[model samples]
Target: MSFIAIDRVSIQPNRRPLNDQKVAELMQSIKANGLLNPITLDQNFNLVAGLHRLTACKLLGLEQIEYRIIAYQDVDHARLAEIDENLIRNELEALERAELWLERDQILERIGLRAQSGENQYTKKGGESISPPPKTTVQLAQEAGYNKRTYQLGKQIAKNIDPEVKEVIKKTPIAKSHSTLLKIARAGSKEREQAEQAEQKAQEAKHQQKQEEMETQAKLAAEARTKLKEKQLIALQSSTAQKQAKQSIRSARTQVEKKINTTPILPGAELGDEWILGRHLIYCGDTAEDKFIGLLPSNAALAIATLSFEWNHDYLIDEAHIVAVLAREGHIQDFCARHRMPFRFEWVLGELYVGIYSQDPILKPEKPVGIEGVEGIVAYLISLYTKHDNFILTPSLGHAEVLIACERMGRICFAGDKATENVDRAIARWQKWTGQEAKKEKHCYT
Candidate 1:
């Protein structure tokens, strides 16, 4: 066809596939070889075809390109012609062919145009009755000389995905496999849910693994602490054992040293109760030296008495023995009082038989009497003569001389010689020798 200037035509807004890189390539080709053919347009000056070529020429900054103007009535026929020409000679890219086929089908549907019928689906009645063939997606791709697989996928995506998603797919540079998978995911709710569950499970497993690792670390730390404590305890026990052994050795050494250094004294012959002299002999002397001599007479008398009794009696009277007997008798009254026994002349004799011993010596006082008599003698003797004082006499000596004599001789005779003639006679001789009566005057006898 003859060519015309591009200024007389307008580009149609129908979708075109001119990307920046494609436009740049086309511009390079145009700069090298120039436009091989012009674009076509309708009377309204809308480009009915050759959109990509116009875009390529514009991007190359060309002031003009060749084109042909046709009336609106001829545009439809021109579009068919243009599609046929590209299918035969141009060999469009798979995606471009798919887009062209889809657009042609939509335009023909809108214009009430039918695809060419198949060979014998219906016979003509009365010269002309034609039925259009049902065009499948595969048949359309085959006619367009496009990949059946690519065309099928594109048709499925166009039908299934929302217009918004399709727009995104068209604009975005996503991989073909990923886009296919996304389309499948959009088509099936089960697939989408399953993918979400797999992602959730992966996260859960990671969290559980982290927790298990933390627990293992904690267990190891606790085990380490226990081992350390046991070691410390063992060390402490060893130290304690060492210290105890040292103390035991020291104690044993001390005891052995003490036993080696110690010495004991031998016992004396006079162990217990060995006495020196009697109270009567002691009273006969005025001093310690005089008392040693005065004891000689009593010792001689005891010796003589001992010799006399030895032939007939089992008991013996030795000087040391007589001294002990006298010392024992000296504590008789106090011994009787301490033992809670009645303190009488007979009690004094009983105390003499069993040795004079007491836990305590401070005896309780006697009951009060109308006129103190026998008890007065005891009081006066205890007050005037005790072991602490120089005048010390046995209970037997005092009781035998006073109370025994009074009991035996009768109270009146013991008081005065006038009560008995015999006593009086002895008294007269005693008085003549002393030149005084041996009677106590104004005696407070009870």
Candidate 2:
């Protein structure tokens, strides 16, 4: 033992951190009874034991500290000596003690000191026993004043937990409690399950909404078909070629007459408000009510499949419907310009983008009539893929385009928008152009 300058000794890298209470107690003891035990240092003057005593000396501003030097074969020897000294004292927190044992085990393994079979049996070499029995991890834990299970739990928490979480735990006495870390892990799993359930419910709600829209569209298409059948029956009753020719001539003459007779019927000029188109109770001008247009699930499905297959892209009928409408009605840009409304249309070499501004008056741009090929594709795909007579249609595309596609494909179309103003205008104009008069009935709205 010799007196050495405090500045000459350095604490070991793996030394247990100084406990403030222990250091203060040691300071009080030294003040009363003087230095009782000298600190231990390695050959290079690094601390091997008595860390708290050295800290106490430093606080007392003592320049020279009593230390005894010991030669060590390697750093591992000196590290194990320091860890063993602290662990035997039973003064370290549970986590700190577990860390010491873990480090001791690693050092022993690196030095090839595992307790192999027959390791306790002395082996004579050059008339001397070469090695003592190596200590096992369980034996070390026991020696460190901890049960096997408790030591293992503490070690697991220190090894696996997030460093930030461990830092927070360090501030509390329960920092080394294995139960605390286990509870946190369980909570994380529960939160994940809750998030998944919420996402599934949201998806189900969206699907139900789409299903309702398809049903509405199907009903509308059924009504349209009924009206079309009625018109055919009327034509069949007058089936003679001569009668047909006369009917065509009369229709043409009537359209020309209406156009030439333009007395400019003002919007408010109540044109004797009793118009009925098939099952529809038609309202003219601003008094028209919104129409619920939708397709039957079966028809909606066919329309969606046709559009998706043709476009070579996956889209719900509503989304595809809009794309189809734009593609068929090539004059959308011109219509937007004439209306002086903002309509976003973007065409990138292979992609077409279109979005309508909701604030603007809806435009009923005309779409071309013939699509025999696309119609066949819808029928073929529907029959091939559907499992039942009726199939659900996803309204991922524009309803207008989907309806038109349904019509051309000889499939029933029951699709309509929530608002009827745009659709009604288009229908009225089409009816007038074809000279088809709606059935009239005397009625008045209050």
State the lDDT of candidate 1 residue by residue for 143-230, as single tens digits.
7666677666655544433343334445333213333323332443333344345455545655778766555555554454444333
In TM-score terms, candidate 2 sits at 0.38
Residue range 306-409, candidate 2, lDDT tens digits: 11212222233332222222223444454334333233232211122223222223332111112123332233233322223233232222323333323223
Count clashing pairs, candidate 1: 0
Q: What value does the lDDT take at residue 444 in candidate 2? A: 29
Candidate 2 regions with alpha-carbon error over 4 angstroms: 115-129, 176-178, 181-446
Which candidate gets the maximum TM-score versus the true structure?
Answer: 2
Task: Provide the RMSD of all predictions against the true structure, rounded to 1 decimal.
Answer: 58.5, 30.4
Whole-model lDDT for model 2 versus the true structure? 0.47
Ten-residue segment with the worst summed lDDT in candidate 2?
A: 286-295
